[model samples]
Every structure is written in structure tokens, then in C-alpha cells.
Target: MILWSARWKSRIGASTIRGMTESSTQKDYLFKTIGVIGVGLLGGSIAAAARQRNLVETILGAGRNPSRMRAAQQSGLLDRGTTNIAETAAQSDLVIVCTPVNHIVQFIQTVAKNSRAGTIITDVGSTKQQICEQLKGTLPAEVTFVASHPLAGSEKSGYEFSDQNLFQDRPCVITPDESVPAEAVSRVRQFWEALGMHVLQTTPVKHDLILAETSHLPHVVASALAATLATENFRYTSTGFRDTTRIAGGDPTLWIEILLSNRDAIVTSLEKYTQSLQQFKEAILNNDEKQLRQLLEDGKKKHDTLNSAP
Candidate 1:
């Protein structure tokens, strides 16, 4: 079982109480040391944000590349760096796996095997269902694994482009199943809150489905839009064109893993999107002004609502 400090109990009663206390408290270094596996953009940003906010006394980084690890250390993003996953997992109070989605389960298993009892583990994988399902009964009983996905990051990749404020005011979804301890859930939620994220709770399946439409679909659309524009057409492009295709610049390898991991949901979303496009095209071909106007108006209203939402 995980043990919480008296301060944690005194501060954590209701969600409202937790928020009030966290905002009022001077220091909230819940973890003594945090181990971040795969210290690239997402991982490096987490380390930088934690250090900037004084959320952890030490941030230990581990990656597959020794040179990248050394560079992360030299960049002031890590107190210590290594290529050994188990060693770092064993030493830290909390371990956050930031590796690619395909490798998340392997890292989680390694962490569980090496980490001490009561250590908390989490990941930043974009999709959750597969990881959560694979880890169902695999982790040590005493070790807590909370699946998390932060809705932040730009089209950019690598630690060089990472920002300490990357997660500030951004949404982070935590998908904890019934098997996870309540205390563990609370700790993970508080950890993300400390990093300046708006925490939301949902199930792994729901997270993947929702993100498939809202995130993955957009990336696909953006890439498709960019692909149609010839290099010679660059001079004709405007801000609207640039804005619509910005995410197309995201790392193709990373996106391929994400798309493949959530293939079912993404494909469903794509089918629906394709139907909508067909409807729009048909309206244009028929010169149905009313239908085109109504479609455009509906889109405008939905976009406006999203912009106005908190």
C-alpha cells in the first residue's frame, strides 16, 4: 500500500479542497525524486517544468541513447542521466515512461520489476487502451500504474524545442481503472496539477476514442491538406493555409505509431469525416447554395463554441 504524508491527507479531502490547498501551499514537492524514461521533448519538458516549479527535489532521466541523456543533463533538464532503465526506476519515488507508445508496456514492465514497493508509475503515451490493458495484471501489486496523456505539445520534436511551460494551462487526462488504488490516483492527479495542467478523468477506451476524433483526425486532415499543395504554390499561400497545415510538420514516425495504436477509432473517425466531405462536395457540385450555407454556418457555430469553451 502507498503511504501519504500527513500533509497530503490534511490537504486532500475533496477535489475542491485539494485545489484550494494546492494553490495556497508554498511548497508541494510530493515526490522526492522523479525518474523520466525517454528524455526527449515530452520527457524533457516534464523534467524542466518540475524543476522550474520545485515540484521534485531531483529529476532523473533515462533514455536509449547515452548522448541524448548527457545532452539532457547538460541542458539542466536532469540532475542525473543514464541509459539504464531499471536502475533509474529503482531509485526514484515515481517513474514516468515517455517512450513511444509501442515501447510503453515494455518500459512499464521493466519499471515494475525494478521499482520498490509503493512506487508510482505513469506514462505520457497518446493512446491508452492498449497500454492499460497490457499492464492490467503485470505490474507488482504494491506498485501503482496510472495511465496519463497530456493534451499538449506542438508539431515540433526533440528536447531542443521543449519548453518548461509546455503543459501550463493545458489539459491532461488520467485513465485509471478500478484496480488502481484511490491514493495512487490522487497522487497522479496532484502531480499533473503541480505541473500546471487542468486534470480530467476518464477511462482508457474513452480517452482513445475522443482523441481519435479531436486530435488524430486533425493531424490526418492537416497532412492531407499539406500534401495537395505543390511547392510552386508556396507564394499563393496565406496565414489560413499555414495554420491549417501546421501540424502536418509533426514527426511522421511518431504519428505513425500513434495512428497505428489507435487504428480502430481513427479509422471510424476518418470514415465519418469522409462522409461529411462527400456531402460538402455534392452540395457544391449541385450548386445548392442553401445547403452549402447551412453546412458552413453549422461549422462556424461549432468552432465558435469550442473557442468559447473553458
Candidate 2:
């Protein structure tokens, strides 16, 4: 979470004194204490990244899972891990909400009840528009809310599967509103960069639109394919089917929350996809060889374009 004050404009480039050492105070401006509200893959990875880079002096991990929190503490993923969410939120300068989308608002309300006035609040949710809207409706005027989406994750879950380098060279989207402090936004960007990510900026609306097509659609399609192919009588599938459906094996609990939370955007994307599929179906039914060839060519070109690096 990154919060900005009206006076931050003057403090943007100025150095701050921390512990008797002025030493290029730019690094200390962003965040010194980070609170991660989930100790699973996303939260553990964030804590690991902060530790690996010494990005944060302290990190507090919070989750309902006692065993997971203890594992995170023992594994050096967080300076402290606790089952109490309010306790973690109170101590953190910046709190990263990494819980399921369904739990986001509840967590925010809990944090508001316990956290100090100036603590920043941000999230790593795939959908931003809804989250941002919820924040505007619920959060206090002092607590700044920045919606972010990290475009990196493995199919694996849990603290044991977390890797320090999970964010390396990956895209992290930071969506800040006009009300958000410029300094706060910059600090959030800086923090992500420190974690070895390529940061990009966008509005919550724009982020939702773009991700609905490129990211959400893929997951929906992959899941649909996986569901369609599974039958009691069916047997003996090859590598192509296995590879294509691999992401469908993602945590159903997580995906259910995601799909439901971002229903509007996903619905719009699915409608467009249905139209495209209808075209392909019609071409196949009519035995339109040229149309089929052109579609394949277009698909190949699109895949190539996506595969090109930044």
C-alpha cells in the first residue's frame, strides 16, 4: 500500500534521514516495513523477494493458516508471521493485500479498524477496476489505495512452492488514481523495481480491459478446454492436450473467486470470443479451405507477436 499526502510534492526528491545516515535517502522513501496478508505463494514470494534484496527492514506475514505462517517464519520469508491480521496491519508502513479477491474487502475493513492513519494499502489482484471502486467506497481519506497486478505466477501454490526470483523480469502493473499521491505512486513503482520487476503504469479501467482480453480470457479458455475434454470414456491423451490444459489445473478455489469477481469483464471478453469461434465454426462447416488457411495464418502471426519480448 502506498499513500500520498498533499505535501509529498515537496518531499518527492528530498532525502530523508534514517538512523543517523543520510546516504542517498531515496531508497528509504518508498517503504521500510511491508506487511503481507497472505503467506501462501504470492505472499511468501513477496517476502522472499524483499529479503533477498533487503528491500524492507521488516516484513510481517498474516494468514489464518497457522502451519503455513510458522513455515514462512522458519523459512526466512518474513521477519514475523502471525494469525492476527490486525496486528500485522498495525505495524506495517505499507500493507500488501494478497488474499483471495473474495476476502479483499473484508480484509480492508479489518485493516481500517486497526491500522494507523498513514499506512498505505495496495493489492496484487488480477482485476483492478472493481477493487479500486471498492476502495473508493470503503477506505478512509488518509489511507491511499493503489491497485496492482503482478503478471507472474506459477501453477504451484503454498509457501513451499514460492521462489525469490518469481518476479524477476516480470511485468507489474501499478494503477493509481488522480487522488493518489504522485510520490506514493513513484515509491510503489520503485519498490516493485527493487524486487526485480519491470513496472508499468495504467488506470484501473485500462488495466481491467487489457487483462480481460490477454490474461483472463486465456485462463477461461484453458479451463473450458480442460473441462470439455474430460469424460469417463475418454482415455490416452497426448502432450499437446496436456500442455494446453496444464493451467486448467490451477487452484479451483482461487480461480472461482477470480472469475466471479471479474465477471463483467470476463463476460464481455467471452462474448467476443464466442463470435470469433462462430466464424471458425462456420468456415469449418462450409469447408472454406482459404478461410481456414487465413485463420491459421492469423493465429500464427498473433502468437508470434505475443511471444516477442519487451
Off by over 4 Å in 2: 1-29, 230-235
C-alpha TM-score for every candidate: 0.90, 0.86
lDDT of every model, 2 decimals: 0.87, 0.79
lDDT of 2 by residue, 22-71 (tens): 55444554677889987778887887777666576677999998876876
Q: Candidate 1, residues 42-146: lDDT per residue as tens digits?
A: 997898788767678678999988987886666566778899999999999999999988999999999999999999999999999999999888877878999
Give the runs in model 1 whose Cα sits over 4 Å from its true position. 1-28
Index of the highest-TM-score prediction: 1
Please report the TM-score between candidate 1 and the true structure.
Answer: 0.90
Give lDDT for model 1: 0.87
Reference-based lDDT, residue 146, model 2: 73
Q: Which candidate is the best by lDDT?
A: 1
